[model samples]
Structures are given as C-alpha cells and as structure tokens.
Target: MVLHAVPPTVPRLLTDRSTSEPDREALVVDGVGALTFGSWQRRATGLAERLRQRRVAPGDRVGLRFGAAEWLDFAVAYVAVQRLGAVAVPVSGDAAPAEVAHALADCAATGLVHGGGAPGWTGGWTHATADGDDDTGDGADLSTSDGLAQILYTSGTTARPKGVAATHANVTYGAGARHRPFRHSRHLLHAFSIGTNAAQVMLMTALLAHPAVVTLPQFTPLRFARAITRWSAGTVFVVPAMAMELLAVADGHDLSSVRLLGSAAAPLPGPVAARLAAAFPNATIVNYYTSTEAAPAQTAMTYDPERPDSVGRPIAGGGLRVTDEDGRPCAPGEIGAVWMRSPAPPRTYVGDTTTSGATFQDGWVRMGDVGYVDDDGFLFLVERDGDLVKTGAHRVSTLQVEAAIHEHPEVADAAVVGLPHEVLGVELAAVIVVSGGAALTPPALRAFLAGRLAPHEIPSLVHVVDKLPRNRGGKVDKRSLRRSLT
Candidate 1:
C-alpha cells in the first residue's frame, strides 16, 4: 500500500499520515491487535469507494451504528463517510428501536451502516454494511472546509435529542496545524464513545501527534485501570463518573506512566478531583468545561489547591460571559446563566429554527447552565438552569447539595433532585450510593450535611441506591431517576 498527502480534512489527515509513516501504529485494540497507518488508510479508502458505488452521494446523512468496543469499524465508517462527503451521524449501538427510529427520522439519513450494533439494520435510509478489511486504493476527495461533516446528536434528557451540525473546519481544527511537539508523548488512552466531542479531540490528536490511540472498547473499573498499565498510556481523557470509578479501583493497577489526565462532560467533584490528583501525582491533572452545542468554547485548568472547584478561565480564542436574566453581565461571584462563543466560526442547529433562534444569537450560544466567575477570574458552575430547585421561598442548587454529600466519607456517590411538595413548591430529595461496608442513615447523613450546606439545601427525603442511573454519556440520568421514583 502506498500513501500520499491530501487536503486538511479528517480523511486526508489519515491518508497523509499513512504516507508520512506507513508502518507506524495508528489504532490499537487489545483483542483485535493493531492497525498500521498504511493499513488503516487502505481499508478506509476502499470502504469509501464501496460507499460511493452505492447511491450514497455527497451531502447525505449516514447513520453509523456500532457498539462501544468496536472502534475499528466505527473509525473506518467515520473516514469512509467523510471521504465520500456525507455527514456521518453516530448512533449508540445499544439504543432501543424507538430511539434509533427517532434519530434516523431526525437527520433524514440517506444510509444506515450497521457495523456491530444490532443483528441487522432497520431504517428508511439505504443500507451499507461493514465487518473489516484492507485493500489499497484512494477514494475521491470531495470534502470542503465549510461543508457539513457531522451531525452529532446530544443525549436527550427532557426531550428528543437535537442534532448539532459541525463543519469540516469546526471538527478538524488541529489536523495538520502547527504545534510544538511533546517531550515524551506515548500512546493516548481514552474510553470515550465515538459521538462525543472529547472523542473527536482524541481522534485529531491521534492523527496529528500520538503514535497510537489506545482505547478500552468496554469500560469497567478494572479493565480501565489495567489498560493504562498494559499500554503505558501517557494521556487519558475521561468524564467525571469514569474518573470516580477509576479512583475506586486504580490502586490495584500500575498508572505510573500517565503524565496527563483530563476530565470533562460533567463537573469533577472536589473530593474526587483531590483523590485523582493524588492517584496520578506526576500527571498534569486538568478538567475542562464545555457543551455539545457551544463546543471548543471550553475552559480548562490544571488542578489548584485553593480554587479546586473553579473550571478555569476562557482559553485563548474562546469567549465566555455570565449574564443576568435580562442579558446584563453578572458581577463577579454572582450566579447567572452562562453564555459562550466558540473559537470556531458560528454554528446553528439543523432543522430546529425555534431552538436555533433561542440559543444561537449574535454568534453566542446560551449554554443553559447557571454559573458564576470568582474574584480570581475562574468560572464555577452552580447547576443547569432547569436543575435548580425552588423550595418554599428560596432556591437551591443540587450540585451544592451533592458536593456536600460527597464530602462525607461514607457517601460514595449522590444525586439530588427536586421532588413535588404540598406546602413548599418543591422539596429537596437525595439519592445516595454509600461506600462498601459503610452504612448511612437519613438522619445521620442529614446531620453530616447540615453544617456543610445551607438549611434550605438539605434534603427532606433520602433514598439509598446501589448505583445512580447514567446515560450513555455517563451523566446522571435524572429523567430516569424521576421515572424510577414515580
């Protein structure tokens, strides 16, 4: 197989990398072995040609359905779709038929490529299938900078998921861009699903910098910990929940090779952050704050002793503001809605003008999160705008309550939500996961938090659960929690 440099699009990044270093390891899986740069380019391009042979043309939406550990199929289809100039929509392989149907209808996808999700595919779109293979040849380079490259669906909690349309430039920011090389970079380990922004960042990093991208196709506490030791992965990215899980079992595994640990997709609880810092003492531990819609509009920080809760300031080229309900700026330390402007050029929702009108205004996207910046210019998220609870005459933040609960040594994990009340408009309710061999009572737990939180923020009712339900993206599925209670 021969390789050559192409354009700056993602497909070209792979093809170009293959040319520059054909024998270098590109994608690594435990049981599936590895794919060299040359082999990956050859296989991905041949699949792109097959996609073109079908009526799957440029500007079409292609749904890619695959399970968690099937990165090889997922990565190939991603390159294949983009190489053919079609917008790829990655659907969770575990989605129910109703859920899959909704996504298929929402994007009006032209093709459904069932790589490894369900037994066979069912969709109105034409179908393309992928197992795995390698045949050398190049496909047509039809991608443009401004063309719609992907339509990533958000994990819908309250309503149907909305599609976020990303342009080629929006997704391929660092591909072939100039950056100083790292001193001792090794493989990058991440267990992120293919659809998330963090996963895309890892993909770009793999193409641009990392010699190989190591992943846990399936994420369990032990498996995640052992992968680090097995691969000697230098960098790892995880959501706060995954980070928590790793904290629980990481002691058994050797993680000395890690030099950079990144957390995002949710707030890293202060206690959890401290534990992770100690666990990876030599690593530069950082947490990022970003949204699906207002992506690349992120703030990051290397963990600080004094400002542990702050999610850092606006990164270079990014914009941020905490504004009152009337659109005026909030004073430092005053809580307000967070609005962000991405470093990438403006983006709007696909086929949802009502939401587009409400969110995308003057190039700024309303983040729908409530937060405040501290005196030292560090941003702190209080809660989601809709997640705030109104109890009697006062409002409360669930995150504040949950943070306090996590401070208790007996509490492993906790989630707070507003429950319907007869007297008060809404009452605070706590769902907790206690540590192993530890027992917690409602009265004792309430007393534990009484000193840490305001009286109004304390839970009126407590329920002990073995685990909190998590969505595909690892966020607490409050909607499911509500359903389970009712």
Candidate 2:
C-alpha cells in the first residue's frame, strides 16, 4: 500500500510523520513495549491490507474493541481503518455487553477488529485483528478530508449514550496549527482508557505533538505517578478523579519533572485545584473543558488565583458564547446555554434528528451546559443543563454542591442529583464516598455545608458508599445513581 501526497487529513498526517521521523519513538506503553514511527507505519499498512481483504471498504463502519493494555494494537488498528477510509467506531474495552451490542447494531457495523482476547459478538459481524494476516498488496486511495472518519459515543452519565460522528476535517483541524503543542515536553503522559474523547486527543498528540506519547497499561495513583518519574515526562493529563487520587499518593514521588498538569473530562473544583498546586509545586495546573460532540474546539485555563472558578477563555481560533432560550447571546456574567465553534465542520448525532437539530447549529455546537463569562472573558460553568436541580422555588447547580462537598476533609468523591419529591417536585440528594478510615453521616455532611451552602442548595438526604458509580469517562453516573436511590 502506498499513500500519495494529499491534504492534511488523518491518513496524510500519519504518512507525513512516519516519513519524516521514521526512527523516532511514536508511542510508549510503559509496561508493554514501545513502537517507533517506522514500525507503526508498516504495521498499520499491513493491517489495512488485511482488512481490505476481509471486504472492508470506504464508508464502512468498523468497530475497534481492544483492552487498555493493547494500546499498541489499538493504535495500529485505528490508523489502519483510517488508511482504508472506513469509519472507526471505538468502544471502551470494559463496556458492558449490552452497550457494545447497541453501538454495533445502531451503526449497522460492517466488521469488527478486536484484540487482547475480547469476546466476539453473536451476530454475523466479520472479525479482523491488528496482529492478523499481513499481506502487502496495492490498494486504491479512497480517503478525503470531507469523508467521515470516526464516531465517538458520549459518556452517557445522565442518559443513554449518543453517537457523535466526525469527518476527517474535524479530526485533523489543528494538525499544523502549531509548531508543537507542548514546548517543554519530550514525553506526554496519560492513562486515559481507549474509546474516550480524551484518549482520541492523546492519540492525535502522539502523531502531531512534539513529545512521544507515554501511557500505562492501567491507571492507578501510584503507577501513574511512578511512570512520570521513570519516564521524566514533562507534561501530564488526568481527570479530576485521577488528580485527587494522585494527590493522596504524591508524598513519595518526585514529580518535579512535570511542568504542565492538565485535568479534563469533568469539572475541577477550586479546592482540588488549590491542593494540586501545592502537591505539584513546580507544575502549572490547567483545566480543559470540551464534550464528545465538540472537538478541536475547547476552552483551556491555566490556573489563576483571581478567577479560581473560571474554566478559562477559548483558545486561539476557537469561539465561545452563552446564549438564552432564543439563541441570542447573553451579556457577560449572565447564565445561559453554552455554545462553542471551531473552524472545522461540526459533528452531528447519527440518525437522531431531534438531537442533531438541537446540538449542531449554523457553525456552533450546543455544549448542553449552562455557564457564563467574566468581564475578562473567562468562562465559568454552573452545571450541566440536565443536572440542574429545580426544587419548589429555587434552581440549584449540582456542580456548586459537589464543589462544596469536595471541600470537606473526609470526602473522597461526591455526586449530587435531584430526586423525586412529591411536595417539592424535586429534592437535592447527595451520594458521597469517604476517604479510607473516615466515617461520615448525612447530618455530619450537612453540618459541614451549613455556612457554605444555602438551605435549598444543601442536599436533603446523603448516602455513604464504598465508591461512587462512574462511567468510562471518570464521570459520576447520575442516571444509575437515581435508579438505586429511588
């Protein structure tokens, strides 16, 4: 298979990097082995040839299910699917069977490529692998910047996951936007699971960023921290949950090698950010906000003491605004719907007209969030639109309550949801996971929040759990929480 010179599409990006820096390390799976650009190109091409033999063609949807430990194979499979101009649909390896089945059936997938001994579906879907037949054969070039490239499902913390489809133009919008995203980093470290938007961003970073991407087979506080020291990683990224865990075990690790620490996939509380600042004394902590439907368009804020609550302004070339019910822009400091825009074409929901109509508009994507902007143009998110708790007379932000809960010394993880209340219409409820050797009760937690929160804002009922239920994106599964609570 030969790739000709083309525009800056996903396939073209891979070809450019491999040809220019074939001997450089492209990917490093800490516990597993590393793969250089040369090896990655050859393996991906061979896999693409094999997939072509299996009758896969352009515009076909191919499912990629590989365990976390199989990052190398997953990378090859993803690039191979792109090389063949097929739409890649990746699901978390640990996703439930039913979830996997839904994605395959919903997309009417043409074939599947799974590794690490993943179970095969019962349906008559053709199966292939990255390590499978490697026959070198000539193939037609069917790739284009406008062609659909991949489909990513939302985390579905509050409802069923929606498939967000993106084209090659959307995926490779910023391929050459900068000389290098992380100037000081030689190795970018993260342990995000496969099939997530975060994981996709990291994959692109491996191909485009200055650093060689490094990841662990699994994510544990100790293991992740140790990888930083062992690899001398200059940049690191994690979600809020992982950041909290890292702080717990940060005492023994020499994390000074890190210059930038980024948190994404969920909100980062003010208190948590303060603690992270002290824990990684030398690192500049930052928070990133974006959704599965919105990529290459995001807001990033390097921690500022003055605007601790802000999620930061839009990066260069991106646009952000808060609008009211009529889709009119709201003034600064006014709470409204959040919308973001990028130069690339926006992604849309697959086969869901109602949702697609509401989400993707003229050139902006509705964030499905409620937030405001400061006079200085920094964005501050109040809550996910669906997470707002509307009681009898007051509207509450779950993010505000959760942020307060995280301030409690005994709290390890917390989630707030509105429960059915016959008289009040809806009542505030909180589910909390206490730190090890710590004991907390409903009354005790409420007492801690007395001065910090208003009466209506405080949770009416609280439950202690060994762990808060979370989806693959490290976000609390509030839909599941409501099911068990009621």
Candidate 3:
C-alpha cells in the first residue's frame, strides 16, 4: 500500500503558488461574505503580521471565540498564527463562558479573539478588525512534525477537559493522508463546529487540496440544505446527529451534486446509516471513527447497507488492536477494548503531563472505546469502556439506549447507567433530559422505549433529572452520576 506524507508546515502547503488561484473562492461564510484564495492569503498574511507586532512570539497560544459567521476569519487567523510559529486554540461560540474560561486557562492563551462580548483577556479581536493587516513573511517558523501546533481539548465526559497536543507535522500528515483520494476541484461542505479537530482537519485538508469550502455558523437542517444547494458542494462532512437532523428536512432540496458524505463524531447507528444511504443514493456515506488524541485512525464503514455496522478499515501508518481485560487479543467478533497506534499521534496533553504519559501505552493509545474487529478487518463499536453498564446479570452498553432514546424527538439529551437494585444487583437505569419545551414523563418514556430496546437493555428505572451531570469537558459524567445514585 502506498502512504502519502504531508509537510510539517500546513500554511506553507495551503499558500503555495500553484494552489493559490486568484479567482477561486477559497472560503464562504453564510451571510457575512466570500473570499477568493488571493484575498484569503493577503488577509491571513496581514493578520499574521499584526499578531507578530503584538509581540505574539512563536509557540504562544491564542484563543479564538467566534460564531460560524467568522469561520473564514478564524481559519485565516489560525493559519496566520501558525505562519508566525504561534498556536491557535479555537473554542466553540456555543460554549458557555465557564467552558470558554476553562479552555483559555488550559492553553494559557496570551490573547483572545471573540466575535462579540468582552473576553477575560487584554488582547482580543472584534468584527471591525478582522481584515486589518498583511503580515505574510517569506518563511513561517513552524513545528517540525514533532513541535506542538495546537491543543484541542477533549469532550470532557468523565472529567475536566484535557488538552490534546497536536503537532504541525501530525495534523498536516493526517490531513494530507485523508484528503489524498479527494479531488481538488470539488466544493466541500463541513457542518461541524470549527473548534473540533474534525472541522479543523476538514478546513486544513480543503485548503491544502485547493478545494472550495462552504461553511455555516451553526448546524441547522434548513441552513445546511440551503448551503449545499447554493454552493453546489460535491462533498460534505457531518456528524451522525447532524445527519439525522438533515434527513428530517431533506425533502424538497436538490442535493444531487454531493458525491460523498463523511460521517464522524459518533458511530452511525446501523439504521441511521441505512436511511442516509437510501436518502443520498448518489453519495457514498463514509463512517469515520476518530479522536482528538489520534486523528482519524479508521474509516470503518463506507455507505454500504450490506455491512452497515462496520467502520471499514484502518488507514496507512495506523494499526488497530482489540484486547481482552488480560491484554490478550480478542478473537474475531468478541468485544474488547479498542486500542490504536498511529505514527503521528498527539504528543501530550497540555498542562497535564501526568495523564498525558498514561494515555499512550507502548505504541498503542487506548481509545477508551469497546468494540471488536471482525475476521475481515471490519470494526464494530459497542460502547465506550466507561459507558458500559453492569447490571445484575447483564452488561449493557449505554450507547445503545442513548441512540434509541435520541430517535425520539422530545428526548434531546439522554444518559444511561446502572443503578443499585436491591434484588437484581445493578438494575438498568436512565436519566433523560428533554430538549426545548418538550415534556417527558417516566411512563411515557418507558412506553416509548419498550419496542426499541430489548427487555434486558431497557432501563428498569427512569429518572427525569433536571440535567445529566456533564464534566468540565462537556461529556456526560457517568462516574459522578453513578456515585450520586449510590
């Protein structure tokens, strides 16, 4: 198999002479405006120069807090910072002030840029100063594949968010490898938040590959459909949740131009994938499983109904291993902890070196996901190891119930766990938190779940908790919840 390698510096690859076309639309923000490659480069270079003038030294961390409208500016600023040998940590606009504060403190950011509202820092950016400077220098001081580029925080399900340190080399290499098969002329649509590694990779890949990118400030079914139609985007990247939302409003939209649909963030439930494949018959639905710690290690399933559950196969320069509790490799079809080893995995967790060293063992990094690889090399994700609910006699995967409950329009947020049961050891339980003004009763929820979940899998007890406890990192804290139940 042939392996593709990317240069250590991503900005250099993106701004190369051949890739920089004066008339090509490099980026488009919904209502704000559009920028051609020539415009984007000039603006990015100017921003880079401004940061340099502000005494932003190489390797300094800069925080970006903006909505989808400023995505183009954010991307350009990100590259600009990299060009100046600085790191850009972009936080989601939807994130709470506390969450924003956590990220800023975690990265020890020297400056912050927000679309609106005052941040907790001295230096920041507003809408007025977005296109102020031209700082493109001939040579950009970047990390040599091993040097740290950005610190992406994980979805803190279990605890406070830990910053995953990604190097310029690792990101560039992963982006290049993933985009190698993609044609450069196609317009790409990404529906994820710019703060996520998935979105970052997509943006970088599109830039490096010279693909036109159409972006939205937030993921809305209507907006997404409209953007697809307006941009004539040939490819799109969506999460399973976004895919479901899009499917709900897909009627009356002309999505004939889309050739490929990349789904990530969570496993595309077999039924959901099937529905998507049916809906977008012309497009190939690629189910990708990746993490902030390890870029995209596997492309388990590829829009084929025949093998719906399979995540596909590992990419080059990466390997997957399924092992039992004893550390021995599990036989085909048997569930085990999913461990992966990537040559260019994240080096460390910023500010938290203790847990960082423990995250990777030998060469394999524990993905914290439980699943098994079949004999044919297909990966099936059962659940996250921490999400496994051990009831009296059965071990259930909370992901199964969460998926089933999410299928209900009223149930916006769902978290499942095992609660202490007097007679049945640990009994299946669920804490359902509804969305919008939707009302959920225990009996109604139980009745709704009856046909969807198995007898053993159904929550024996249901609680209409005000809010399921989420850790600092935004992931459901089952351990903390379990402790409260006990």
Per-residue lDDT over 277-312 for candidate 2, one digit per residue giving the tens place of the 0 to 100 score:
988878999999988998878999988878776789
| Count of backbone collisions in candidate 3 | 13
RMSD of each: 2.6, 2.4, 4.3
Error of 2 at 299 (Å): 0.6
lDDT on C-alpha atoms for all candidate structures: 0.79, 0.85, 0.72
| lDDT accuracy of residue 41 in candidate 2 | 78
Better of 2 and 3 by TM-score: 2
Could you give candidate 1's per-residue lDDT for residues 1-486 as a string of tens digits?
222233257777787788978999877766666778787788778878888888778899988887767777778788888888898888777787787777778888886886644555455544444555585455677877778888888878656788888887777654444552333556877888777767766666667775488887688878988888888888888988888778888776788888888898888787777888889867888989887788768888888878777788888478889999899999998999998886675666779978898788887988878999988778988888878788999988888788788888787788998888889978888999987888899999999888888899999999999999987777899989977875
The best candidate by TM-score is 2
Comparing 1 with 3 on lDDT, the higher-scoring candidate is 1
**TM-score attained by model 2:** 0.95
**Native-to-model Cα distance after best TM-score fit, residue 202 in candidate 3, in Å:** 1.7
User: Candidate 1 — what's its lDDT?
Assistant: 0.79
Runs of candidate 3 with Cα error greater than 4 angstroms are: 1-6, 17-20, 116-129, 132-143, 174-181, 401-415, 430-454, 461-486
The model with the greater TM-score, 1 or 3, is 1
Candidate with best lDDT: 2
TM-score of 1: 0.95
